[model samples]
Target: MANADARGRLRRPDGGPLRVLVVDDEPTLAELLTMALRYEGWEVRSAGDGLGAVRAARDFRPDAVVLDMMLPDIDGLEVLRRLRGDEPDVPVLFLTAKDSVEDRITGLTAGGDDYVTKPFSLEEVVARLRGLMRRAARSDTRPDSLLVVGDLVMDEDSHEVRRGGDEITLTATEFELLRFLMRNPRRVLSKAQILDRVWNYDFGGQANVVELYVSYLRKKIDAGRSPMIHTLRGAGYVLRPGD
Candidate 1:
């Protein structure tokens, strides 16, 4: 776990500073996290309650989220649902009680990517978030830079995707998942493979996040049109040109 310095600062795939949303009812704790993340050269936003967290997420569009399970309102689990209900399967790191195994289990089962026990160091939080971002980053240097399968096109260098000449807007995480699908074309990517490549965090075998994001992609890429993304029952997901 090397320190993030100005010279070696990590950035988002779009070449912008990484964004993180910190949700905690304690103003002092939230401010400390905010300052630490900012010092690492990333954008930071904070919310004191569940509703505010959801609102902040919409306005901030953060790349990652640091959530506190003990919230002043609505609790952390509900907030996680609200956030996922929106868009972009942003990696969530839950802060929980040190002795509460149940809190840890519930958080991961509810779609949190990772967590840190209370009374933890700020350095640990920063390191964990950095790891998530590193795994989420797109492979920018590709020999095929441009991927084309039928009417769908993806430009890795430009971070752009188009289907049937319609430009499709995607979040950083969505773009990474779509890019993996396009790169493989008709190949069936297993849940394990997708998790390792798309989300490197340990979710204790939890993989519904894959299903959730795929559903999101379908609404945008296949809604009211031929479906290019397909689920193969017992297999995994396969992306092909729509008929």
Candidate 2:
């Protein structure tokens, strides 16, 4: 698709402009990136450090993030972890130093969706972001937004989760993980599969996130109630109707 057409299609679900967070210590660069994104009819916000980046992300709920790998308070990887903790599905594009191979590798390995080296072209950054946004659009497409298995129910469009006629709250990551489980009821889903299908990126090889997120889901989804999420030893996890 043409850049303009593709950009037009990548907007908020509410039909508003796409929200983008630009995090860079350099003011001039940040301004330039912001201007470019804004020209594309997006709502743009910029942060100058890791702390500000994290804070802005929470407040803005951006559709995508442009994050620098180095920051005054925290590195980009740590910022990514914090961002993913809350907004699991937000795509991130890293800004690494020119020819910094290690920075590029570490950024992607840490779950950044894409990266552009410093001294890069504005067109390149915008283009890469378009690509990431496109991939995200495809990943997010599903047949049914309402998913049910037993007493647990999720309304994907409304972002509501409830069980046993009671409201249940979950972070962005928790919700997506649960949705993936609910979509494939009674089927074993390995950590590898979860990483590939749900997360779509490895956590610097820290695959334990599968177990960690599962535990989080259990606390919210199954505690003090009939268990629906199950772990088969040496196998994987599955979701089914509770007894």
Candidate 3:
């Protein structure tokens, strides 16, 4: 279990500083973020526009990105799309002036891991990045990244899920929900628990979301096969071998 130092600087497996890319159209803000990250002993780079951000993402290969929602050439969402086209699971933190629910939802729905509003404290940004790094580390060190239940197989590293020897593609959210079920095979998980673990409490409490995602999972993982996901009436849901 690796821990950050007093300054909250993260280290890679090779003991080098964690690399971060800051993408913001505002030069001063970008420089501020760069300086703050550098103070934390992280290797930081800045891209003042969306195009440059996309270019740098390919060239810099940053561990995490701090991207502004508003960019010059293209919007931050487009930049994120381009980045995800190459790296589906890249960690991103969006900085946005509009803190509306829709905006937040849009960012998260687009695969942004986290978001920070304008006029944010530098410390808060650093903290969020640190949390992302920790999660990334945990994900990398998974003792068994490949999960199998019956004929369904999920490879965490490659983000691939297969059922009955047929490849199944899933959205990021769907993949996460299915992974959670696979990890707890045969154990009944309530909608509340699923929501908390999968979408986080920040998403508010919507039990229907669990049902919806489960339905989505069923279509992909259970259709035309002995269903592995089971509805236990009042007990919630479970994943186990189907007869």
Q: Which runs of model 3 end up more than 4 angstroms from their true locations?
A: 1-9, 143-145, 149-152, 163-166, 170-178, 185-243
Error of 1 at 94 (Å): 7.7
- Per-candidate alpha-carbon RMSD to the true structure: 7.4, 7.9, 4.9
Residues 1-243 of candidate 3 have per-residue lDDT tens digits of 234556655786677788899999888998899999999888998999999988999998888899988787998889999999877766788897744555655776666776777888898788778766676665566665799999899998877889888999876567778888999999999887886666544333356557766877798888989989999997789999867
Positional deviation of 22 in candidate 3, in angstroms?
Answer: 0.7
Candidate 1: regions farther than 4 A off: 1-21, 26-64, 67-128, 135-144
Q: Report the CA-based lDDT of candidate 1 relative to the real structure.
A: 0.81
Writing each residue's lDDT as its tens digit, candidate 2 over 1-243 gives 112245355676566788899999999999999999999788999999998999999999988999999899999999999999998878888999987877876676567766777788898788767766765665466445778899988987767899988999775556667888998999998888886666555334535657767887898899999899999988889998899
The per-model lDDT (C-alpha) reads: 0.81, 0.81, 0.80
TM-score of each: 0.57, 0.58, 0.67
Candidate with the greatest TM-score versus the true structure: 3
Q: Candidate 1, residues 1-243: lDDT per residue as tens digits?
A: 112336767766566878899999999999999999999888999999999999999999988899999997799999998998895457788999989877876786576766788898898799778767674543434444788988989887777788988998765556778878987999999877887777665544446667767876787788888999999988899999999
Count clashing residue pairs in model 1. Answer: 0
Cα deviation of 43, candidate 3, in Å: 1.0
